[model samples]
Target: MKGKKILFILSGSIACFKACEVVSALIKNGAEVQTCATKNALNFIGEATLEGLTHKKVYHEMFESGSYLKHIELNSWAELTLLCPATANIINKIAAGIADDFASTLLAANDYKKPFLIAPAMNVNLYLNPATAESIEKLKKRGVVFIGPETGLLACGVKAIGKMSEPAEILKAVKEVL
Candidate 1:
């Protein structure tokens, strides 16, 4: 994975901590990582931590000056894009072609010419909802890949299948595709 360019996107979730582990592992393996976060994701994981690990500024705003076309540039730059700890909101937005936020904009703008992966983390009910199921199907048909939201104890106090995959598992998936 040396010198591979990965666009790591983070969404709002308690599982951002797990995503951090994946970022660290990616850098350790010599993959170049750039992060773009949803506004809510930063509420859970600090910008400092992401910057410290990625060594690149996290882009979370769609209208930042001189970055009006940044999403397109990022899409062109990345060999792979991983949306870690993906939320139902973001998933639905991307499936519906909504680009209200920076992260959603990035997903919407991507034509899926490169590998795109999402690691979902949310309440089991949301994950299992018909709307989310349809959304996942929509993206999958468009060639987007999904990693595990494994069955386990959730932060919402429910032991169910809404947890994001562990870092090692996600990294393994990344390796497999690359």
Candidate 2:
């Protein structure tokens, strides 16, 4: 994966905290990483941590005056986009093509033919909700791939399939696609 540009989008989930490991793993494999955190995801993991790990700017907004139009540039820059610890809310938003935030905007701008991976993390009920299922189906039909919401203990003190998969597992999925 040398020189592959990986855009890691952290959504609003407690598991977003673990994305540091994913970033580290990707970098260790000689991949270039750029991270973007949703406003809600930042509540759990600070932007500094992501920026520090990526050694590049962490985008977290839709409208900002800067060197270039970030949303469009980032979509073109990334060779692959991975939504680690994708929350139910983010899934719904992306499936619906909502671009309210930087992450969602980048997602909407992505070419469907490009590699896109989503790893959803949410409670069992939310994971099984009709909207969630529908969103997943919609995204799947659009060619977005899923890593896992593995069956295991969750942050909410429940044992179900809504847990984020391990960083190694996520890395493997990324490798397979890229």
Candidate 3:
């Protein structure tokens, strides 16, 4: 993975913390990683932590003046894009071509020629919602790869299939995609 440019996008989820491990693993394995997060995801994981791990600023806004064309530029620069811990909201937005937020905008503007992966995380009901399932199918048809919302104990105090896959699993998926 040396010299490969990876864009890691994180969405709102309690599982956002695991994205740090994904970033660290990517960097440790010699991939250049740039991270972007939804505003809500930042609540679960700090910008400093992401920056510290990635050696690059965590982009959390679509309107940053300094990064006027960041959504486009980052896609062009990355060899792979991973939406680790992808939320149902973000997934639906991307599936529907909504670009209201930084992450969604990035997805909407992406050329889709690169490897694009999404690892969903949510409560069991939400993950199993027909809308969410349909959205996932839409994204899959568009060539988006999904890692997991594995079946297990969730943050919501239930044992079900909504947990994000572990960092190692996500990293393995990233490697396979790359």
Candidate 4:
């Protein structure tokens, strides 16, 4: 994955902190990472932390002055797009073609021929919900790849699936892809 361009999307999930480790690993592997975050994501991991790591600004709005096309530009700029700590909300939005927010809109603009991946992180019940499950299936059918939401303890303190894959594993997956 040396010198690859990765557009990383962060959604609202406690796993955002863990996803930061993946971002760091991507940089160490010589990949240039640009982050796009959701408003709720910043509630868990600050924008400054993402900006500091990537050395690029964190885009969380669709209508930033002088960069109204930022979301489309980001999609075109990336060789691969990965959404880590993907919450059920974001997943469903992508599946349903909802792009009301910057993060979701950027995802909607993803180039289908390019590698697009999502690593889901949410409560087990939410993960297992019919709506979320259907959304995942829809995305998979549309050629979007999904990484692990491993079975383990969750932020809510219950042991089950819907845990985002660990940083090392996520990095390995990214390496294998590009």
* Top candidate when judged by lDDT against the true structure: 1
Stretches of candidate 3 off by over 4 Å are none
Ordered list by TM-score, greatest first: 1, 4, 3, 2
lDDT of 3 by residue, 87-106 (tens): 88998898888899888888
Write model 4 residue lDDT over 1-178, tens digit each, in one string: 7789999999999999999999999998899999999999999999999999999999997787866999889988999999998999999999999989999999988868999989999999999999999999999999988998999999898999999999988888888888
* The 10-residue segment with the lowest total lDDT in model 2: 61-70
TM match of model 3 to true structure:
0.98
Q: What is the TM-score of each candidate against the true structure?
A: 0.98, 0.96, 0.98, 0.98
lDDT (0-100) at residue 36 of candidate 4?
Answer: 91
Per-model lDDT? 0.95, 0.89, 0.90, 0.93
Cα lDDT of model 3 overall?
0.90
The residue-level lDDT of candidate 1 at 112 comes to 87
Off by over 4 Å in 1: none
Which runs of model 4 end up more than 4 angstroms from their true locations? none
lDDT score, candidate 2, position 143: 96
Q: Evaluate model 2: give its lDDT.
A: 0.89
Error of 4 at 40 (Å): 0.3
- Tell me how far candidate 1 lies from the true structure as C-alpha RMSD in angstroms: 0.7
In model 1, the clashing pairs are none
lDDT of 2 by residue, 1-178 (tens): 9899988999989998777899999999999998888899999988889888889988887776782478788888889999998999999999999987788888888887789999888999999999999999999999999988899999889999899999999999999998
